[model samples]
Target: MELVINKILNEEDFELYLKTVESFDIINPFYKLLASNIEELLNDKLRYFTLKNDDGEVLVLMPFILRKVPYLEDGQVYYDVISPYGYSGPLFNQDMSRGHLITFWKLVDEWYKANNIISEFVRFSLNHNFQFYSGVLIPTLSNVRGAILDEETQWSNLKQKVRTNYRKGASNELRADIVDGVKPEDVERFYRIYISTMKRVNADTDYFYSLDYFKNIARLSKGKILITFIYKDDTPISTELILISGNTLYSYLGGTLMDFFNLRPNDFLKVEVMKWARKRNFKYYNLGGGRVDFDSLYSYKKSFFPNDEDVIFYTGRKIIDKEVYDKLDKIMNAEVYLEKEEVMEEENDSKISFFPAYRRNAFNR
Candidate 1:
């Protein structure tokens, strides 16, 4: 087996990567175009890693974002690798023996160390792809997924509250329309409601995505994205941006105007989106996890599939160079002390659970 790294610079290479992804039957929201768009916004580099057999058939594929470490003035560049924002990790084309997986990871480690990689992080897929990695794994939040194979069964399985809210929205004459394709005007409308929702909840700066970012996503991932709007008469009260992959529909980002909360637009919007996905033969509707496990957000998503089992999300963390990682951790700790005018022992302790302990502050910032 040989490991191939595709930078995906030109159209030919990009098409090749897409073909490989399809060959593996691995489909998720974070494909090349979306990842490239996000990396471009963050000024990072995207790399596609694939392990192929002697016949040039792909066995495993994974995409990573190479982010340069901050505050490193040692005249040498160091980088940390992370999976794309959403659910993604190493995807195997087919079940392999233990020996094959061992060999694959060995090659992966060699490549990371050969490059100037300091650390690696991965967010495993929620669809239960066979993942093999020699790293510390943590069971993160649980995402609520509703199976929508049969429309009748899905509606029958909905929680009473969700059913009631959807009915309420219908009674209020709130209508939902799934945009045929992402349009500039629809993106603007979605951004307006999304920003208002973020501000109402006091979301972090990182979550306040730029309008240009949304526009770029629509442009780059044209066919893979779906935009749905909930309208009251002539005004849109709620909107959701969904990502499509294989047979699943992921509720990527969405928001509801607080003033229209009484209309139950969100609940009604979700039901309509599921129906739309079901008609398209999608199997699952992944309502991602909340800010914290079992929080109000999680509870709200759970209302859709009250009896469905929780799909646990797992994250993998690994430190390639321990010595360099320790040095950076100390530097960041001192910087934090200087900024806060006190030793943040508690904060540091809390951050120990976070991987690459050095960049804990960066994430918070």
Candidate 2:
């Protein structure tokens, strides 16, 4: 059987791509409808590739953004294919045999080569959509657990300490409201608190999102994005942005005031979010992974799903053009590259762990 691989380029095919995503239950909200808004705000190009049967029924879809590698001059074209900011890899609706997977990958490799895509990075969804999809892609599974919402015993599953924090916040007069979409004022408040939280943690500048970014996300998500803001006497203390895809809610981005940390607003915020998801009949509330597995942050999220096992987040990277990749690598690490701007720093021959190291600091503002 011949599998037709189609690349969706302009608006004409983009409309069909969106319709196809809406028709299938194979992807999360990030890949389904939010990718467009994200691309618009980030000023990146969307590259959607799909595989279909001979009958024209779509079988697999891999949506990625072609991010240009910065600091490179003209004629030295290279790109890194990355999933848009969240959990999305390749989505497959039908069961595919090993042969099918291999053939699809071969065709994808050809497409990547023709497009000058030097490397690919993917973050797989935790909803079990693309699990065990082994072919040429290998993913590193993380030790993280997504908190499941159990109608019967979701509350009972929480750790005693977690419940105590939840109560503490309530007793301290902390409250939260789940808004349909993040309002302009709330976006401002969220960004202020979010920036403060980032500064508190000494986070890299790359993690700091602009106010316009949040606004665009809310606009793009349509009604799929929800914001729960924790307030202490009319003053916003913490806020979380949740993304709904199918029957699951992802606790995507959040921020809490460092001064009010003792009030346990963040803890109460999670409890309230879970309760809302439960009442709305959501199956899971994916409290995302921490900086490291089983760390303090992960432990806090894990306490909510005491009866359920931890969910592993998977990631994969593929080098599409090894020769071009090596050339870029050499250029990035070369003395000439470093001396181009008359920089003063000791050069280390040791390789950095960043993927396609040439574009490592591309996001550093």
Candidate 3:
């Protein structure tokens, strides 16, 4: 099939875009939500593009933000292009299978060389149960990235702990208002428990984005974003942010009032949302994979992912114009140009997930 690459200008065109990628999976919500977030949260504007065939088939989708590295500029400007700005390989039509994957990459590779754009990595951060990327090659990387897979078959019968917790939570009486809009104050209520949830687990809760950021996303998504509140006798106990895209309903972010353990608001709210999703004709709900390996959160997500699948991230590096990068490094940081041997030595000494410069600029830049 002959493929044509085109850029999308607005949400009005999104429905047409969906026709090309028919199988709505969990990653679909990631594409929709991230595009919404980047258009709002990013300091720079993001461009959307699609790869379609002569038969009008959209083989792959790429949505990217044009991020310029201030400290790493090469005078020749290019972007840190991540379509979706978060996870998954290029979004492809599930029906296409692996047929067009290599072709899609070839197109992408040629596009990068021609445009002088360098894509160091594409993060597959979506929470889904699908094992192995359906239509893409795992890029060359030294280490195996870790992920938690939720399989319904392995869990349909339920492990003893999963059965117990789910049963316990199932017995609790609860209700949710899964309406189209979200009040800033309602979200603020969620923030309270969200902060506590972070602290309880000692996870970093550095919320860099302003309140205005989320408000804009809710608006841009055209009511596809739903903020549900679980209430107990007029008191709100928990809240969830859910987005519908394609055939999937994604459980984005959730929090519960720390004091209302008796109400079991969180558990109640999830089941309620799952049932609501079922009524809406959504095929799958991505509750999300946990950050910690084999944690309670993983169990909770698995409880809902009946016959679910595991998703992993592959980091890609296409060193387009090495001459440009070399010169840019000399002007930027002393640490940017270390050899593989030195990098291995450094890795052996210690592991650091965040860089000092990037950490400083994460919020402001």
Candidate 4:
């Protein structure tokens, strides 16, 4: 079977591409709908890469942004290879064989070289899990799984701590309601709490999304996106933005007032979201992982699924131009690279792990 590879360039092609495959939570049609919004915000180019059969049947599609690299003379670019936020990777319609994957990468490499793409970074999906990646890049990173619930599962499956917290939240009269369609005011309120949460965590400035960004989310996700709010005495305490795509319910973004910690509002919010998902017959509710390893945040998520291992949150990076990448890396980590060959070696024995270290600080993370 011969496969033809092409880059999607127009709105007509993108809309057609959306119709070719089943929807995904992280890379769904809704996610693609918001691509233009993100491009307008970040001044990047949204491009779709596709591998299709001779009969024009699409097998794999990857939507990514071409972000211009700063400090470059010739306008070099790199593929984000996923949406600006959330999890995304290659979405497949059929089972991809090792040979098919190898061919796909060959096409991708050719396109990368043609576009002068210096490198690429990808965040793979959780629902449509793939155990391996081939060619120039492979996934060495993973996302931890907080919990996985079955349709027939009982509340008893949850950790005692989680159950206790749920009860505590109930005792405090914390109530959660899922919005049918999010409003501008609702997004603003959520953003207020979201901003506070970022500040509380000392997150990088890039985490601070603008109001227009949330507005665009509400507009693009349509009815598939719901914001669940936990309220006490009609005052919002915790809120989570959920995206229903395919058979999985993703707990996308959320925030809670730290002041309501004692009331266990966060725990109650998750319980309510899960109950909603269960009622809808959704197969999985991805609670998502923490920023790092099993820290306090992970501990909190772990309370829900005490016995489960973390889900692999896979990530990959590929460098297209080795010389350009090294030069950029050295420029970014000049303090380490600028020192004498002998003196630098002894002074800094450790090597930097940041991919294309020159663009390390470019991301909000």
Candidate 5:
């Protein structure tokens, strides 16, 4: 087997990479639609490492974003790698022996070290593809997923509160539309509601995306992007951006107008989207976790699959070069201290807890 690292620079190469991976029955959510858009937003380089056999068939594909550390001296550049946002890690096209997997990981370590990658952080696939990860694994959060069942069974499985909200939305003349392709106006409407919702919740700056990002997603994802909008009378009240990969549907990003919260537009929108996914024979709808464990957002998503087992999200943290990692950590902490005389214990705890602790205050810098 050979390990091929692809850093696609041109559109043709990017398209070819997508085609090659789509040919396999791999469960990957880090497709180009999401990764490429994020790459542009973060100004990071994206690379894919694939293990190919003698027959030239790809056995495993791992995608990551390489971010360079700022203020480094010329020719002494250092980088860190992280899996793209959402549930993504090494995607396997077929199962392999444990020994082979071990060898693959060792080679991966060597490659990262040679490439000056100081640390690695990964959000493993929600499908439990945590094989051969010789890193610190932490249970991050719980993602709520609903298995597509027969219409009768699916409706019966929802929590009574969810059903009541749906009923209320219906009674209040809230209608939902499942749109396969996005238009400029549709993106504008979605962004207005989405940004407003983010502000309502006092979301961090990272959660706020530009309008062009959504436009790029719509343009680049081909037909794999779906937008579900909940409308009251003629005004759009809630909207969700859903992604399709393999047989699963991901509820990627969404928001609702606070004024229409009483109408329960979000609840109605989710049910309609799931119904549409079911009709298309989709197997799962992954409603991602909230900002914090068991928060209001989590409770809302949990109402969909109240009886289903908790689907925990796991993150992998690996320090490739401990010496450089420690040096950087100390430097960042010192910088923080010099800038601020008083530091909250809670903030310090959060910074230390983050993988690549040096980056915890990256935005503040």
Candidate 6:
């Protein structure tokens, strides 16, 4: 079957494909629903592509943002379909086959070089089947890839680990205080814990989002974000933020004050969260993927979240207009976030607002 690729450039087109892609079970961003006013968020410098056969059967889908190096572009363009958080890649329709893919890639290659974006397409270590995918794409699989999986009948869960750890830690009374009400003030404490954890791991703060970003998401996402703080003795030793949308309650973020490590606060925290979900009758908990098979982080995530959701990722690229792309590559490689930025980053020692209105008012000199 003859195959052709087209970019989504209209409101009608976006909606049509969105409904079509839902059957694939891929997670579409909530922002996508508000495509009209928030095109920047949905398409946002992104180039969404659609592939179909001669019979007009939707074969495969790929959407990427035009990652424009504005300073270097000198007014040129190069783009790759990417995910901001997760589950943003390809959408293959029913008619997908090897032959159609080959044709589509040739077109992509010709298009990329023709556009003068690059010599070839590069996808950042993204897709599982890199061998089959061609054109301008490099799958970036190395950047902390993981899956949400439930352990087999044999593997130990998080609760079991906690029990063992509690014995090891020789804890006092293992109690959990559940707070039904959630507040914005909690996010600040959560950020502190997350920031502290990141510092412990020597991670970059770029991944650490600002409070405004969190506040914006919480406000805009409607009832999608469900946050639960687990406490013991009226003190929050550990807390977990679970993003609830549809049937999945993704164990999104968690942090703890190191002082309560003795009571196995984390283990207890996980169990309580799991119990809440089971009580409320939620389906899945996205424990998230580990860096590699059997990594320590993966092992830790496994204790509470055992459902292994094998998510599919899609990517492709092409040197659309070769003359335009060669310069683009040089420009892309040349750009880098300098190391000095880190050296200059010092923790704020002065009193500042942590969150709530009262806190901000109290801190303001």
lDDT scores in order: 0.79, 0.70, 0.53, 0.65, 0.79, 0.49
Decoy 5 TM-score against native:
0.88
Better model by lDDT: candidate 1 vs candidate 5? 5
Q: How well does candidate 3 score on lDDT at residue 215?
A: 63
> Which prediction has the highest TM-score against the true structure?
5
TM-score of 3: 0.64
My TM-score estimates for the predictions, one after another, are 0.86, 0.80, 0.64, 0.80, 0.88, 0.57
Whole-model lDDT, model 4: 0.65
The worst-scoring run of ten residues by lDDT in candidate 4 lies at 344-353
lDDT of 4 by residue, 68-145 (tens): 666555664443233335666677644456566666667877778776777777666764434345423444433434
* lDDT (Cα, tens digit) per residue for candidate 1, span 194-313: 999999999988788888878877776647888999999999999999888778788889899889999999899999988888787788888888887888999999989887888898
- Count the clashes in each prediction: 0, 1, 8, 5, 0, 53
The clash tally of candidate 6 reads 53
Tell me how far the alpha carbon of residue 180 in candidate 4 is from the true structure, in angstroms, after superposition: 4.0
What digit string (tens of lDDT, one per residue) describes model 3 on residues 1-365? 54454444455455555444444432454565544454433354545456666876555665555456555343556544544544554665445666566666666667667875643345543432122432223422122111222334323544455545545555654557786666677556666655566666566544444455556557656567778888766777778777766566666766777777765666567666665765666666666555543466676666544344544434333355566555544454444436732553356321122222221223313
Note each model's CA RMSD in angstroms: 3.3, 5.0, 6.7, 4.5, 3.1, 11.0
RMSD of 6: 11.0
Off by over 4 Å in 4: 1-30, 33-42, 72-83, 95-99, 127-132, 135-153, 335-352, 361-365
**Least well predicted 10-residue stretch by lDDT in candidate 2:** 343-352
Q: In what order do the candidates fall by lDDT, top score first? A: 5, 1, 2, 4, 3, 6
What is the per-residue lDDT of model 5 for residues 167-241, given as tens digits with 9 covering 90 to 100?
999999999888887787888888999999999999998789888888877877777888889999999999999
lDDT of 6 by residue, 1-365 (tens): 43344345666666665665554543333324223224444544545555666776666655554444333344544443333344444555334466666666566556555554333233322234344566434332222222223333212433476557644433555555544444577667666776676676777655566665555545544456666654556666677665654566656666777777767777766555556666676666565556554578766765553444343233344333445444443443342334522322342421111211111122120
Error of 2 at 323 (Å): 3.5
Query: Candidates 4 and 6: which is better by TM-score?
Result: 4
Judge candidate 2 at residue 309 and give its lDDT.
66
Q: What is the lDDT of residue 230 in candidate 4?
A: 90
